[model samples]
Target chain A: MRKYLLPFLFLFLFVFESIFVQYLPTEMFGSDRITVPRFLIISILFLTVFSSRKYGIIYGIIFGLLFDIVYTGVIGIYLFSFPIFAYLMSKLMRILQTNIVMVSLASLLLIVLLEIGVYEINVVINQTDLSFADFASLRLLPTVVLNSAFIIIASYPLKRHFEKFMASVSD
Target chain B: MPQFFLNKRLIILLVSIIVLVALIGFSLREREKVTWPEQFLKDMTGFVQNALSGPTNYIAGFIENVQDLQNTYSENQELKPRLDKLASLEAEVQRLKKDNAELRDIVGKEDALSQYEPIQATVIGRNPDRYHENLIINRGENDGIQADMAVITANGLIGKVKNAQSFTSTVQLLSSMDPTNRISAAIQAEDNKKVFGLIEGYDKDKKLLMMTKIPYDAEVKEGQNVISSGLGGVFPEGLIIGKVVEVENAEYGLTQTAYLETGADLYDINHVMVAKITSMSAEIQEELQSTLEEEEEEE
Candidate 1:
């Protein structure tokens, strides 16, 4: 029961933020469309801390594929970017096991880089005029701040659960 | 853990990626033609989406009906005494008439225009996320819509039919913020000189209808009319693009900013027109010439 609690709760919260929280106080922040939100990056980071390395990568890939299918995009964007994030987090695992701050910083760096890479490739190669204005300031800064905070605050309980899981499996 | 499961997952992933790539390449190859399987998928998706949207549509329709009934009920009560007078007013239809030939010509033009074959559709779904402006209409391959079919209305242009499945089609509206929406049109005036422009959507702040490449010498006024250039093979000449409300020249030179406003109210539109262009002779030649010039300039 406790093991499923974190994934379950985070899933609900992410969905709520994805669907609803982004629309509040419509007078100021409302717009026509949003690019892929950075919540996905934060989700991947949390899962890396709690789940197995292989499991984390698999989940990210599956999530990316789902994102591609549900949204009208180039179909392989999330598919490509997500696996890279998974691999990086897995590599980072050895160096930073107990530190929440390191995970937050790493995830934020990857997300910002990922946005620039995707936007540039689409604009240059495909000639898709996806606007990068929202991405640079209001969207990126707020997303990094909010997501890093969530990941840092949520890491302790997740770390404990993973330790217990490792113990049970080893025994 | 054994490696068998990992091997299986790898195989599945590789196969899926291959399939996705193949489909993309396939679509790119035949960008102009409508495939049968894609048509079927569109129809089936529309059927499912329409089934899902039935309840919401019913509620909205029901609310509208109640309001209409309330208005009619009061109007009927008030008009009871005037009904006898109105009946006499209608009798002049046969007696008091103008030039018969002129009236017939007036009626004949729109009658021919309205003779277009159309499949009625309901918008079953929109892009679930707030990121893209796309709508899925319930009419698809089964409804006779093919890829590139013009989706329009009695008044003006709405969009084009992109992917038509069996019973549903994904309509790419003219006002879509996507940069690909380069509508070919001309200014409707004495000159009717050739013109082209791009239409982009904004949910707020004067949903824009932006035109490009109009020469500075072109005598364009703020209230001057814009129409489909007919130079493009896709749209017929003189479909009302919009009334040009403003124009400005930039320091960059050569091209003036033609701030156009479209006639189509996408937010209120419930129906559209899709024209299947048959003869591509004159229009195609003109399109080819203009496009070549534009490409050369880019080069």
Candidate 2:
């Protein structure tokens, strides 16, 4: 039962991403910036840093596929990006010191990469016509701020949870 | 480091990238319906979304109610005068409806393009990614919803059903930048005339609907109402779409374009109605089908 906690947590975040994020008032941001919740991806990054990279990539693939099928009509965007980013993060973790600040910064970088990749694909497929400058200012900046804030607040708690869970599983 | 080209991980990455490209291309085609596996996954996610959103919406509604209380007095003061006018307006509408029905009876015509049945639905989830403005509703194929059905609110047209699963459906909002998302619309002109055009795209900067292909000589004013023309055969006629806010000529000077402010607020939506156009009669439908086939044969 305890071994299932991490997957259940990721499931909750996945569901909350589609269901509750829209309720946050756009008027608070004054309508210029669009703040997207990448909570699932952010937490998966933390899982890679604090727990096992293998488990993190596995969860990333599972939840990424779910995100693709449930939210977007396109399938391969998240399905490919999420696990790729997790693997990249795991490699970066080997070089950098493990701490809250580094984890948050690394998560922010991964998110920027993911957003730009998705945006470029959208441009090629003619799904959007937003200029590169406008995309950087309007969507990319605010999304980074929002996700970084989430990572800052959630870093310690998630770190502790994953450590405890890994202990119990290994036992 | 190991030889880069010979690494097993590199080979796996190359294979997956090829697979990803294939999947994206396959899904990008114009599909009539999703496969059963995709439908099953959508239903499963939609079920959980529905369950979770109910309580969240209740809590959000409570917060909104509290906020509304602060404006209640001023809102009531403004609405009091409108209340008196509403009664007379209601009477006028009733009289006009009766007259129109009598006229239709005299003409021996019972079927109208505006005839439709409304299916009420609750919004269960919205796509987190803001690029594609899509809403998942609690109603689906089980509720007689089909792809391309017009989804509207009491205010006016919002979007159309993109996909219908077993117990849930996805609605693509008008603001999405899909090139194929075109609607046949008409601008209400002077003396009860209508200037027909295609609502071809959306201007993201201005947050307005772009109506194009109007004749250069057509007179479209800033305040004119835009409604679906039903020429597209998907949306019902006379469904209010928006009000024109600006007009300009095309670059080639052969056609005009207008920007319209949508009647329904695309961002904040909770409940909607799917307009199911009622086919006239079996005999008429068969006759129409036969005529269409004959026209195709001539072509």
Computed on C-alphas against the true complex, the DockQ of each candidate is: 0.09, 0.72
As for candidate 2, its clashing pairs are none
TM-score of chain B of each: 0.63, 0.93
Error of 1 at A70 (Å): 6.0
What is the CAPRI rating of model 1's predicted complex?
Answer: incorrect
lDDT of 1 by residue, A65-159 (tens): 54443334345656656776777777876777546667667777777776676666445444344457755553455555655666667657655
> Highest DockQ: which candidate?
2
- CA lDDT of A142 in candidate 1? 58
lDDT of 2 by residue, A1-171 (tens): 668877778888888887655687473445857888999999898888888899889988988888877788888889999899999999998888898789888889999999999999999988889999999998999899888888888888998898888888899
Model 2 chain A lowest lDDT segment of ten: A21-30
Candidate 2, what DockQ? 0.72
Candidate 2 Cα misplacement greater than 4 A, ranges:
A25-30, B1-5, B279-299
Docking class of 2: medium
Misplaced by over 4 Å in model 1 are A1-70, A89-114, A129-134, A138-171, B1-30, B33-133, B152-158, B175-181, B190-207, B213-217, B229-233, B236-240, B249-257, B264-299
